[model samples]
Target: MAGLAGTGLSGAGAVGMALPAPPAGPPAQVGGLRVCERGDTTYLLDRSGRVRSLTYARLVPDNRLWVRQSYDRAGRLTGLSVSWSGFAGRLLDVRGSFDARGRLVRESGFRARGVTTPLGSYLRAVPRGLTC
Candidate 1:
């Protein structure tokens, strides 16, 4: 995905959402990137202090979904993916792309059927330094 070009993620993702505060340990620095952990969630910040990626667990109804967000070099969100732990391992639920202006462009996957996309929610919840 275009947004993933400089972030090392090969899949689609983008944007940042409010996550719980980190527990106690300091953020870890790796190769100029800062990794912050809060419970089952992790946020990766680039050298310029932009969110590069976010991986977090979300509860939906009776299922627990793992969500990932990927951003471009400018810290603009581009794509998102959701998955869930299954008997066969992690099963993808939905994957969507966002236009540069943060509109949901395309989404697919069986679990995505009939569900309102969360693009607006994520855009509204984007954290301080990140852009949707």
Candidate 2:
């Protein structure tokens, strides 16, 4: 049986899974940030030229997810926020503050309009290690 790497599905017989390729065109420099667009998602680079954050939208469910990240001068993520929308305009928002080594130091959650906390699913969708 084949196993997937980094997806936590090891030994589950999953195989040949890969993330979609980024947009084919070159990234454009806007102000101090580099912007790359892939379909409905836009990735933003921090001052250190790292992919610091992104925002994506889904049409099928008519929802959107946005990630905000802050990095110190050395390019290590120090703060992160992952937020998503639900039906009826509800929202689930979570924040995480990380230490110098990227270990989460504090976590906070907020809800508006009685939305379900799909925080786990949203975090899983994120590119791992950037979560709270």
On TM-score, the candidate that comes out on top is 1
Per-residue lDDT of model 1, residues 2-48, tens digit only: 76788765563345534688787666786777987656667788877
Judge candidate 2 against the unseen true structure and give its global Cα lDDT, from 0 to 1: 0.62
Cand. 1 TM to true fold? 0.56
TM-score for each model = 0.56, 0.50
Pairs that collide in candidate 2 are: none
> Which candidate number has the best lDDT?
1
What is each predicted model's overall lDDT from 0 to 1?
0.68, 0.62
What is the per-residue lDDT of model 2 for residues 1-132, given as tens digits with 9 covering 90 to 100?
234556667664445657798786656776777776656556666555566665665544767667666666566667767877756664767887878986778879887865655443443222433211
- Candidate 2 runs further than 4 Å off: 1-27, 39-41, 46-48, 112-132
lDDT of 2 at 98: 79
